[model samples]
Target: MKLDVTRRSREAMRAYLAEALDGCYEGEPTISPIEGGRAAAERQLSNFDVRRYASRNHVTRGHVSRMSPYIRHGVMTLREVRDAVFARFGRVGESIYKFVFELAWHQFWQEVYAGLGDEIYADIEDYKFPPPVWQETLPDDVARAETGLVCMDEALRELYATGYLHNHARMWFAAYLIHHRRVHWSVGERLFFAHLLDGNPPPNALSWQWVASTFSSKPYYFNRQNIEKYTDGTWCRQCTAACPFDQTYDALAGQLFGNA
Candidate 1:
């Protein structure tokens, strides 16, 4: 059998987002956002606005987040991507391992999240919820923040302009969104699914929980300055990668790197 994929580079994926799927969504999130968190682990919503991903750089929405949804929904399978890679790299050794690792990395996280306590769907139990809230009560301000409009960083603006974001940048983005902004990661998670083309529920949802300390907190806060040192002045001018907190940074970076 011959399998031909017209590859959509991260760049191409961004361009095709809203354009490819706009006619879906009849009402406002049939499943309310907060309550929806606990629904069926995840729901596969097909059809999205083509215009949503058509910004000169909308690939962030249409392409990147779309992958996991399709894979999760049975529209496509991980096996397909694997077969394509295996054909080129074959089995065994680091070369093949590297290729397989990326896909597996995605899978591993999904599993990790499924087992998290049901509370994983929301913020840490210990934290207090202030305002009376509901699944459907998503404020427009919160919507703007997750889209990277709340912050004034070039990395974030680019994230807004382009739908795609480097995985590394997402970590920083989530932490800042959850911590600095005082917004719940679950809120952030919902926005991600709404906008991301490659949004994988497991990785996307659980990762947000992890960052918010509902999961783990060895490096309590990812240092902002440390990231600047590592990136060497590239990416995230508005939000530096260096973690603001230190002790947690030392302990956490280890787990993060190991996991990554």
Candidate 2:
């Protein structure tokens, strides 16, 4: 005798079955799995080369070394990555300088975390202006990837499906959550930590604070123009929602903080 099941029950059964098979895979992953161990990391280091280091900010134009997972897990040391860059580019120049500056940020965050310990999870500085009204919990729309913002929804989907995002995309999403959605940074930080393969507590939490203006001199914001420029207008082209990021920086400042 077969029992009839509701749609919700069917979904539950599927999810349970998937969870049960989680680590039993003997075949290739649907998405390219980030290979583990020192050999894979070394290969990635070789591919990063010097040119890629110079173009890290050209999110839509070029590639970045997808080596953060290796770095985060201690499979590749920070010093080793730096040495590789230096060897390829020499000690000083715009490209080498930019690359080292970014590396320094990771070390700086680690130092701050070591000093503050768990306090790194809290607001590091007073809000530069009045804080926006915020909920401690992540918004349902963001969690469900139903935010109606094409750029944000796409970024969230990439993060969930691949466990990675371009660094610019991360900043854009964090700023949207903190200043635009008016959610606390901690909520976004926690969400990032949960999904990011490269997620480290210090860098994840501190970087969110940097975007929210709790650690920086002012909040970071991006409008439609900035997104279009960096993303090559892909998200803006087919977007149907009324874009909150459509305004100029001055206008956004006025709307977000009553300052222009």
Per lDDT, the best of the predicted structures is 2
- Taken over the whole model, the C-alpha lDDT of each candidate is 0.50, 0.84
Give the 10-residue window scoring lowest on summed lDDT in candidate 1: 29-38
Please provide, for model 2 over 9-102, each residue's C-alpha lDDT reduced to its tens digit, 9 standing for 90 to 100: 5445545545667786433333425666899899988888665565676566656878889999999888999998888778977767777787
Task: Estimate TM-scores for all models.
Answer: 0.51, 0.87
Those runs of model 1 whose alpha carbons end farther than 4 Å from true positions after fitting are 1-75, 109-120, 123-152, 217-220, 229-231, 235-260
Predicted candidate 1, C-alpha RMSD: 12.5
RMSD of each: 12.5, 7.4
Q: Which lDDT tens digits does candidate 1 get at residues 1-260?
A: 22224863444543354345446633222221211121222232222222232221222222222344346555556776566445544565654565456669777876666676455576543432122222443456444444443232444544445444556567766765565555667877876666565666777777777776665643134564544544553434554434333345545445333433
What is candidate 1's CA lDDT for residue 128? Answer: 26
